[model samples]
Structures are given as C-alpha cells and as structure tokens.
Target: MSWQYVLELIQNILISQTGIPHMTWGHGIMLLIALFFLYLAVAKGFEPLLLLPIGFGIFLVNFPIVPLMGLNAEGHMNLIEYFYQYGVASEIIPCVIFLGLGAMTDFGPLIANPKMLIIGAGAQLGVFVTYVGVLFFGFTLKEAASVGIIGGADGPTTIYLTAKLAPHLLGANALAAYSYMAMVPLIQPPIMRLMTTPEQRRIKMRQLRPVSAREKLLFPLIGCALIVLLIPMVAPLMGMFMFGNFMRESMMVKRLSDTAQNSLMNIVTIFLGLSVGATMQAEVFLNWKPLLIFGFGLLDFVVCTFGGILTVHIMNLFLKEKINPLIGSAGVSAVPMSARVSHVEGLKADPNNWLMMHAMAPNLAGVIGSAAAAGMMIAMFQ
Candidate 1:
C-alpha cells in the first residue's frame, strides 16, 4: 500500500510488456495506413468485403511483434499465419473464390460471341508487359511474374500465382489487384474515352442469339478439357471454376451450387482477406519493393485497358459487324465491376446503349485469361 510498492509494480509491468517498448514510429505509420484502408472499406465502401478484414489484419500484424504473423520464440507458426498457410499459401482460398464465381457466372454471353475470347487474351498484354518491365527494376523473374499479375485485376489469381512464385510479395500484389479492381470505374473510364471516340462508344451490335441449356452444360465440359490440356498448372483453380459452372448449368445440384456461391464463398473470403492483411507487417510491407509494385500495378491496369480497346479496333477492321469498344475494357478480371464500368460508360455516351450482357463476355473471358496467365507464371517457375 506504500508509494514504493506502487512504483515497483509499475516498473515491473512496463519491463514485462515488450511490445510497448519495442514499438517504433514505423509501427504507428503502418497502423495509420491500415486505418485509412479501414475508412475506405467502411465509410467509402471500397471493396468492403475484403478491405475490412485486410485492414484489421494489417493493424494486428504491425503491433510491435505480438505473435501474429510468423514463428514465435517457440518456433511454431502463430494463429493468423496458420490461416495464411492453410488457406492462401496452400492455394485453397483462391480456388474456393473461383468456385463461387463460376456458380454465379452465366457463360451465355461469351458463348454467343466466341470472339470475346481473343479480347480477354489481348488484355493480358499488361501482365506480360509488366512482367518484363519489372525485371528492369532488378526483380527476379519469379518476383516480377508475381507483381505483373496485378494487371489482371483478379485478386484470387494474383494471390494464387504470387503464392506459388513469390510468396513474399503476395501482400502487395493482392492489395494492388484489389485496389485497382475497386477503382475500375475510375481507372478505366478516362482510358476508355482516350482510346475510343464518342462514336465508337456509341456503336451498337445486333442482339446475341440465345444459348440453349444443352450448350451451357456442354460449354463447361469443353472449356475444362481445352484449358486444362493447354495449361495443366491451372487445374486446381480452373477445374474448380468449371465444376462450379457445371453445377449451375446442370440444374441437378441446386443446393450444392447455392452453398458454393453463397455460404462457402463468404466463409473463404473472410479468411482470405485476413490472411492477406496479416502479411502486411511494417517490416515487410513498408519497403521500396512494395512502392514499385504499386507503380507497376497502375501501369499494368492502364496498359491492359488500352490493349482491350486496341484489340476491338483491330477486330472491327476485319469483321462485317462492329462491336462497342467499351466492352473491351471489361477484359480485366474484376468480374461484373469492370463489366459494369463499361456499361455505365456506354450509357453515358448514349442513354439507349445497353452493353451489360455484351460486356459480360469479355469480363467472363478475363477470368479464364487471368487463370491461364497464372498457370503460365507457375510453369515458368516450375
């Protein structure tokens, strides 16, 4: 009860809590950055589903080394690190997301116009371009491959490929991919406008033929066979994606398809986000490499968007029918988001313009294209 006792107790507590003393100004900076992302996810509604968990993970992992991300003094992986290992490092979470995506997607649009496949492949120019560009920055081929995938704008593919080729850079690549995806509406529009005139944006094509259920069911089988045969490395993600689509098209496993689309997808997304965020410790994330990755990511997106539009122009030169160039911008794998951006831009050019279904073709194809790109990256390292 004496003053001496109180002072001694306070000294003991401060000495025991290592995190309190070991914390540096860098920790504060990272924490603030995490808070800003939280604001974007919560208040600004920027990819809230992933950003919210990712922001919290960043906050938790940077708190002066409290056994969150890596091996402890006992030489065992910590809790969050386990999630990163089993869920992402093992490539389970990304494949699960693809399964959900396949269940939700309708291949009708891409099926009706098989040419959209080429546009999706064209958009991958950003991936290859950035891959070669990052090598000039002294990155290893594997590291550059991981970084280049940010151009694809497919977070799962980015995570999957980075985990295989450059696990260390997974945090930056995932963040860049998701950030650009969330900003698709903003990053794509100016590029779309600059690449194509108002007349090109307003161009309309004839209505697409309605695809039959039999065709939908057959498409997944054929797609799976061809894609897997070409890129055996893509079997995990692509196989799951095709299986999910088959489930939806089959109409026989409605309950399983529902679970894949809704319940399982929701669960994996939370774990995936947190694991990704946990990788962003101050020591690892606050570096020149991450900064460079961000720069390249922006360039990748701009170039990819440009490539898609350019492909459309080239195709129009040879075809009897002209398609709206805006749909080409959907070739980045942001799913309906990139597609929706193209649709909104089309509407702005001409209110009567409806490009949603048309844009879905390239949007859907981008998913496959990105997966194939990821497989190629994995093959390079293997």
Candidate 2:
C-alpha cells in the first residue's frame, strides 16, 4: 500500500479502536456535575450505593471520545440506551425492581394498621398538585403527568409511569425520583415539624395489633385483584409488587423469593444505576428541564409529607383514638428513609416514644398508593 493510504487506514483503525471520539463544553460541565454527585454520595453519605455508581456512569459517558454512550453520527445505541429501550421502555425494569422491593419489604406494619391506608392516599396529593404546576409551565397533559409522578417518591413507579407516557423525559424523571429520595432527611423534617405542634409530636403511638398470618396471606392476592381490577393499566407495577409479596408470604418459593429480594435486585440495581447515569450526558443533563424536574420533585415530597400529617389530624377528629401525626410523614413513599426520618424526628421530640413501627404503616402504604397513582397516570395518558 502507498505510505499515505497506510497512514490514513491506521488513523481510522485507531479512531475505531478507542472509545474516545470528541469532546464539547457541555460534556465537560456534565463531568463536573457528575463529580458533585459523587462527592455527595461518598463524603456526605447521600444514597451512596446508588449515587456513586450514577456519578461514575455520568463521568464515563461524558469523557472525551468515549463511545460508551454511542453519541456519534452513526447513532448505534450503547448499553444504556439498549436497556432504556428494552427494559425501561418495555416496562420490565420497574416491575423487576418491584419484585425485589417486595422481597425486601415486610408488610406487617401496614397490615396491622390498615387504617393508615388513608394517609397513604392523602400523601399522593403532591402528584396531582405538581401536575397542575407542570401544566402551568406549558407542558401538555401527558408531560405534566410525567413530571407530577416525581411526588410519588417511588423510583420504580416513576420509571414505570414515565416509560409508558413520556419516554423522552425518562432521564430527567429518573434523576428527579432518585434525587428526591436522597433528600428525604432534609425535605421531611421541616415539614413534619411545621405540620404539628410539640404536643402532637410528643403523643405516643399505641402498639400495633398483631396481624395474623392469614391476613398477610390474603392481603397480596386480594390487593392485587382489587388494584388491578380498579385500574387495569397499573396492574403491571401493582401486580408484580403483590406477586413478590405473595411469594415471600406463602412460603412456597423461598429460594426464588430470596433471589428476587437480594441477588437479582443488586444486579439489576447496578445496571439501572449505570444506565441512568449514562443517560445524564452533558447535553441532556445541563438543561432547564432537570432543574424543573428537581424542583417539582421536592415540591411533591413536601406535599406528600403534609398530606399524611393533615390526613391523620382529620381522621382523629372523627375517630375515638388519635394517631400520632409524626407517623404521617412516612407517607412520602421513600421506603425506609422517610420512615427512618420520622423515627428520628420523633425521638428528638420525645426520647421515650419509639415510632418506628407506627411510621411503617404509612411508609408501606405510600408504596402502594404511589404505584396506584402511577397507574392512574398511565391510564390517563394511554
């Protein structure tokens, strides 16, 4: 071959062999943002397991010339987009995550205090309230619904509903969902304090009535049927949640159930984190939408927290017994974080009162209620 031709061929090969391609100002900025998240995750201990990987993924995808995210003219999808299309868009990831969540969760608290279900429903006020906020921002109904879902405080439910309705906003929505989750300690305490006085916060909760194994056994099956029949669109998310819980409760598939709750979940979480971070490439991350998404998410969390507190207060007016309003803060649906914060806040008010079990009632209810709300968004959009 001629020397010139040989040199040209070598250059092409090098370009193709290395993941690096090009760089831009936007990518550089995203790299910094990614590092910020990493710092928060590592030093601050803010959702480290999730945020650390997410920050790393963002860094990898934004690096100069890296083909990790497939942003070239050829437009071949990288691993992130592949999962986004097959698992996320197809609505598989959320359901799988739910399966894992169900395996990890204990429904004893919720089942024991079924009356707490109302607080869970009330907590969903943020979803609808934020829907109006998004609408005012000029988003169409579908987009508004997508933004509003950040209030649900459940990551899988956010993804599940957004994938079904507004696929383009998935990255922003996912980030919002997780970011708000990490902020539960910061977001909930002020609201919890503001919503109730010292006396109310000091009120101790009654010990939960024992829930029979029979009640636990029937709950998943009946809840599955009830939620799905009522809102068929939400069935995928809700059904998976119930099915996983049933597998755990029934004692029939101990091995499968254990795998779902532990091994499978860890594996999926890694993939989900990396994939989500990859989507946060600079051009995508540095936008007004992300800010709006984050803001709406915070607003949603605040709304849910107070909604639960107020609901408990209202319920107390008619009922003979009074429920501690602090427990209502757990209705934000961030699993144990909101519940833990509720517990910690309660201890600060009164060291003698242990409200962990009480908060759990609303915490678990938020999970189901969020899924139900997500399902409603899906149905309306579909």
Candidate 3:
C-alpha cells in the first residue's frame, strides 16, 4: 500500500463515498419529537404514566446505534421482541391490565342503572365510524381498524388490537390513544356545553335503585361469557377483564387476586409503557400518517361525546324519566375522570343536582360497553 493510496482509502472510509449509504436527517427530527413528547408528558400532565416512559424510550432508541431495542441472533428486538413473545403475543398484558381495572372498578353504579349501558354503547359508534373514515383515507382495512380504535380511548384494547392487526403502528397508535384519553377534559366540555341547553342540563333524575352484592359479583362473569360467545376475538380483553372482576368479587383468591390487582399488574404497566414507547424512532417515525391518524382520533372522541348526548335526547322522546344529559357524557368509560366531569357539570347546572352517584351507572357501563365494542372490532379485523 503506497502512502497516497492509504490516504485516499482513509478519506473514503471517513467521508461518504459515492453511492454509499449514510445516516439520514430523519433521526435529528425524531430527537426533537422525543423531547416534545417528554414535555407533553411531564409539564403538560398528559397521560404521564404511559407517555413519560414512552418519551424516554424514544430518546433512548434515537441516540445513534445503541440497539437497546434491536434484534437478537434470531432477528428481533430485545425489548419489543421479548414482550411480543411473552407480553403482547402471549396476550398477557391486556388481561393483566384488565385485572387492575377490574380490581379498581365498582359495578354497583352500573348494575343499579342499566340504561346508561346504552350511552356507553352509543359512544362506541365513534370507533366504527372512524374505522370507515380511516379506510377512506388510504389506510388498509387492518390499519384503519387499528387507527380507528384509538377513538375508543381504551388503552388496553388499543394495544391489544394494534399488536394483532397493525404491529408497525403500535407505538404511534398507543401513544395517541392514551394521550387523547388524558385530553378528554380539554377536548370534551366545549362540545358538550354547546350541545345542550342550561335547562336541559338542569334536568334531574330519580336516585338509582340500589344493587345487591350478589348481582355485582355475577355481572362480570355472565357478561364475559355472553360477550365472548358473541365475539370471540375480544376474549383476550373481555374474558380476562370479567375474570378479574370475578376474582375480586369472588373473595376466594385474596393473594392471587391482590397480586393481579396490584403488584403484578402495576409492574407490567411500567414495562408495557416503556417498551411501547421505545418502538418510536425518527428513522421509522417521521411521516404524515401518524399526525393524520391522531387528528382523526380527536374527531372520533368528539363524535362519541356527541353520540351519547344525542342518544339521551332521542330516548327522552320515548321515556318519561328526565335523566340529566350530563350523565350521558360519562358513558365514555374514562372511569373516574369522565364520571367526575359529569359530577362537575351537574353541579354547575344546579348546586342541588348530585349526578356523581347517578352518573356512576353510565360511567361503569361505559367500561363494559367499551370492552364489548373493542371486542367487536377485534373480531371483525382479526
């Protein structure tokens, strides 16, 4: 090797030679996205439990060539592949999270007032509507289904379906769904306020008929079996969800149930959030599709809210009971938040209207209704 030849070889290796591959500028842009997500998760208080970890994961993956998430000799990412193999692929995380949800949830409100179940079901119209909308926008049938369910604003179902139908969109879709859920307060009230009159909001209903403990214990299992028989694909989500509730109400496996309700479930959520977040990197993430999907997600949430209120008015034509329309808003199953929003709105309408307990029926029904809707999507798409 002559000195001149050696110098030329070193220069060729150090700099980009003609037609050789090099890192693109996409990565730099992705880093900025990571920071933005982090800011939203932290200072903005946007689904912080899920988003904070996800933002950290995005930052970690884009830091050049760490391969913290990359494949093994078998050609799969250590974290993603492992979870898919054991976490998502096994269909464990969704079920595990359901256990936590079931343990934490109360069914008295829902069972006491069954008609609110209709509101929850009505809210789910957005899920299917968005599915059709996404397809019109050029996403494939499966991709559209995955994107549309983000509107349902149910985190586990979002993850469950995306993992089965649109794995590539998993990170973006999960992030969008949870983020939109956190934004419910900001996104909902204006639309809800406009849709109803102050007088309509002031309409109060009778107190809920109290539900028995036995009815509470029976509802989950019976609902699970009936729903699963109707749509088997959602079994992973619905079955485990009901099973968890059954476990909690059964009062038999205190240790096992407690583990599922608390420690085991919490640990899995942290892993699921981080692992999902890690999948986002600039090289793979910079595009118009995710932004469009996110916009559609917002539209879906708004439509679902409207659907609930509209249903109440339509039903009012037939039913004599003067149910507060605010309770209908809680039918989206945002759990405590959506329920609380109904309470707040009712208080604003009239200081005497204590719609929280009454709203609880619709709020709890929203959980089952959302799960059933999620199950339907899974069956249709899967």
Candidate 4:
C-alpha cells in the first residue's frame, strides 16, 4: 500500500472503531449532567450509596457507542441491560429493596399510636392531587400515576410503579424520587416552619406505649393480610416488605433478617441504581417529559408535606391532646431522615421536646400508605 492508501485505511479504522467521531451535543450534555450528579453524590454526600453508582452509570452509557445499555449483535442484552431486564423491568429489584427496608424498619411507634395511620393517608394527598394536575399537563393516567408517587418519597415505590406503568419514564421518575429523598432535610424544614406556629412546633407528645413482642410479631401478618386482601396488585411489593419485617420480629430468624437488610439489600441497590441511570442515555432522556416530571415531582413533594401538616392541624382540632405539627412533615416516608428532620426542628422550637419517636409513627405509616396508593393506581389502570 502507498502512503495515501495507508493513511485512508487508518482514518477509516478510527472513524469506525472509536466513539469519539460519533459524539454529539446530546452526549456532552448528558456527560455534564452525570458529572453534576457525581459531584452531588461524592462531594455533597447526597444519597451517595445510590447516586454514586447511578452517576457512574450515566457517565458510562452516554458515550457514543458503548456496549453497555442496549443489545449486542447476537441480540442478547448488554451488561446493564441484563440488570434492567431481570431486575427492573421484571419488577423484582424494587420489591427486593422493600424487603430490605422492612427488615430494617421498626413499627413500634405506629403500633403505639394507630391514629398516625391517618397522617400517612393524609400525606398521600399530593399523590392524588398531582395525578389530577399532571393530566391537565398531558400526562396519561398511567404516566401521571407513576409521576405522582414521587411525593411519597419512597424510591423503591417510585421505581416499582414507574416500571410497572411507565417504564419509558423510569429514569426520570427514579432520579426525581431519590433526589428529593436525599434533599429531604433541605425541602421539608421550610414547609414545616411555614405551616406550624411556634406553639404547634413546641407541642409535646406523650411517650408511646411499649408494644409487646407478640404484638410486634403479629403486626406484619395482620397488616400484610389486610393490605393484600384490599389491594392485591401491590402484593409483590407489600408481601416482601411484610415478610421481611416478620422475619425481623420473629427474633428466631436473625440470620435471614440480617442478610435481607444488609447483604441482599446492598447487592440489589447497586443493580437498581446502575440500571436506572443507564436508561438515561442521551437519545432517551434528553426530552421535555423528563423535565416536566422533575418539576411535578418537586410540587408533589411540597404538597405532600403541606398536606401532612394540615392533617395534623385538623386532628389537633378534634383531639384533647395536641400533636406537634412538625411530625406531620415526616409523613412523607423518607424514613428516619424525614422523622429526624421533624425531631431536629422540634428541638429548635423546644430544646427539651423530642419528636423522633412520634415522627416515626407517621414516617412508617407513609411507607404503607404510599404502597397502598400505588396499588390503587395499578388496580385502576389494570
């Protein structure tokens, strides 16, 4: 081959074999977005466990021709696609995550104060409201349902519902849910303060009654039966959750509970984050729908927080004793984080006032309520 022929051959190889020549503005924008998420995960410590892997997955799939997210020439799924198919698309990973969550959860506070269940239901106001609001914005019933659950602040439920109803919107919905969950400390306090008075914040709740071991063990069985009988569509998620909790409460299955809470949970979370992030490839994710989903997600969360506090005010009007309205914000179910925010805000209002245990009642109730809401929507659509 002559010099010109050799050079032409080299150029052809470079163009065909490498991703650089095919990179587009969309890929660059996705890369920047991925890096921003990485910064939030690493430097800012926002949901780092999920965000780190998710950010990295975004970085990996945005390259022009990475063999990571789609199918290969033989038609088998690529690496992340396997995770997505079996784990997310099959709706297994989210339910597994719920099992882990249940294993780690304590229902004592909710059991001691069953009235807190109403706060959990009340917190769902935003879910239904957003569902209606998004319809006017052109989201279909299924898509709106998937988007609205972000208010619940339950990442797995968001993923589960989105995967079931609107798999196309999974990346946007999951990121929105987890992003808000990580920012619960930032988002909830202002709403809490704005909705409650100084006296309301200072309202001290009596300590919860100590629940018996039998009661704790029986709760999961009874709760699971009631929820499943009422909303069988949620059986996979709720059943696993209650089963995990049952194992924990049994005290006879320490090994199984520990594995579910720690090892099993961690393993699935990695797959879940990566699978979700990979779905955000430039061609798929850089769109108007995702932006709308993000906006609606924030509104939903705020309204849910507002609804929770309002529920408390309504309850206090009827109760002889008062509830600290700060705990109402914890009804969004960001777990101990939202509950802790309530506790901290309570301390700011009254140094001696402790609302952690009280806040936990609605916090845990929000978990169940969110799931029930998801079940309701699934039933309606299916």
lDDT (C-alpha) at residue 218 in model 2: 87
**Candidate 4 lDDT, 64-178, residue by residue in tens:** 9889987999998999999999999999999999999999988999999999999999999999999998999999999999999999999999999999999999999988998
What digit string (tens of lDDT, one per residue) describes model 3 on residues 96-200? 898788877778877787778888887777787888998888999888888877867788888888888887788889888888889888877887798889998
Which residue ranges in model 2 land beyond 4 Å of their true spot? 1-21, 70-76
| Candidate scoring better on TM-score of 3 and 4 | 4
Clashing pairs in 2: 20-65, 20-66, 21-65, 22-65
Residue 279 displacement in candidate 4 (angstroms) = 0.2
What lDDT score goes with residue 345 in model 2?
91
Give a tens-digit lDDT track for model 1, residues 236-297: 99999999999999999999999999999999999999999999888878889998999999
Question: What TM-score would each prediction reach against the true structure?
Answer: 0.97, 0.92, 0.91, 0.98
The best candidate by TM-score is: 4
Residue 70's lDDT within candidate 4 is 79
The candidates, ranked best first by lDDT, are 4, 1, 2, 3
Model 4: lDDT to the true structure = 0.94
Which residue pairs clash within candidate 1? none
Cα displacement (angstroms), candidate 2, residue 17, comes to 7.9
User: What lDDT is reached at residue 307 by model 2?
Assistant: 89
Q: Can you write out model 2's per-residue Cα lDDT over 1-382, one digit (the tens) per residue?
A: 8999999998998777754456678887898888998898899887876788778888888876665765456877766677666767688878999988887778999988899999999999999999999888877788788889888899888877877787767777877788889899998899889989999888887899998888888899988898899999888888888888998888889999999999888887777777777778776678787788788888988988888889989998997778889988888899898889989998999999899999988999999899889888777766
Query: Each candidate's lDDT (Cα)?
Result: 0.92, 0.84, 0.79, 0.94
